[model samples]
Target: MTVFDLPARLDATNAPAIEQQLLRLIQTDKPALLVCNFAATDYISSAGLRILLLAAKTLRQQGAELQLRQMQPAVADVFRLAGLHGVLNIQN
Candidate 1:
């Protein structure tokens, strides 16, 4: 299992870094657990959710897993509203 420290802001400005990190994590040979912390972020835009959705897809392909933990409510709402709560496993 590996932990990922999400940026303070994960909007349009950080999309590239997020995508790169997601790819890097997927390259691992073993099944992985990616714990993402979004507490530093007050809110996330659709762009941020887009990145997470992509990461979830990658994790599925690799037979690994990704989770959102230590997330603030404002940000969690992003996932909920997107109907992603059932898709992404979140732990707090």
Candidate 2:
């Protein structure tokens, strides 16, 4: 398992960069399980959700898994409202 800590804010301003980092990690490490820690993240814009969805897809293609953990209630709500809660592996 590989664990990654997310930034406090996930918006268009940093979504692209975060995407690159996640892609790089998945490509380089090829971990069977990738866990993103959202303990510090309180905000998530649509852009952030997009990257996460992309990451989850990419990981699935590699027969790996992406897990989101400790998300704030608000952030989790964003995912839920976007209908991503069922698509991604999120753990409260």
Candidate 3:
């Protein structure tokens, strides 16, 4: 499985980088493990969250696995606040 290791910060400044990495992995003709790191990210806006949703949706369509892990309490709260905790599987 492929693992997409994300940085602590994933704001607009590095969204493109994350986008590129995600797109590259999803297009691959094999299963993958996307372990996103958000431990240092204290904030995430709607647009930023959209990136995760998009990635997960795309991966699902492509029959790949995307697992998010080590999410900061603040960041996980963002998912709960946005009502996406159930939509995406954020490792505990």
How accurate locally, in lDDT, is each candidate?
0.81, 0.95, 0.76
TM-score to true structure, per model: 0.87, 0.98, 0.82
lDDT of 2: 0.95
lDDT of 2 by residue, 33-70 (tens): 99999999999999999999899999999999999999
Model 2: residues with Cα > 4 Å off, grouped in runs: none
Error of 1 at 22 (Å): 2.1
Which pairs clash inside model 2? Answer: none
2 against 3, candidate with superior lDDT = 2
Pairs clashing within candidate 1 = none
- Point out the worst 10-residue segment of candidate 2 by lDDT: 83-92
Q: Considering only N, C-alpha and C atoms within 3 Å, which residue pairs clash in candidate 3?
A: 2-33
Give the Å shift of residue 33 in candidate 2: 0.3
lDDT of 1 by residue, 1-92 (tens): 77777887888888878888777766754447777777687778788888888887888877878888999887888788899899889997
Error of 1 at 90 (Å): 1.0
User: Which candidate, 1 or 2, would have the higher TM-score against the true structure?
Assistant: 2
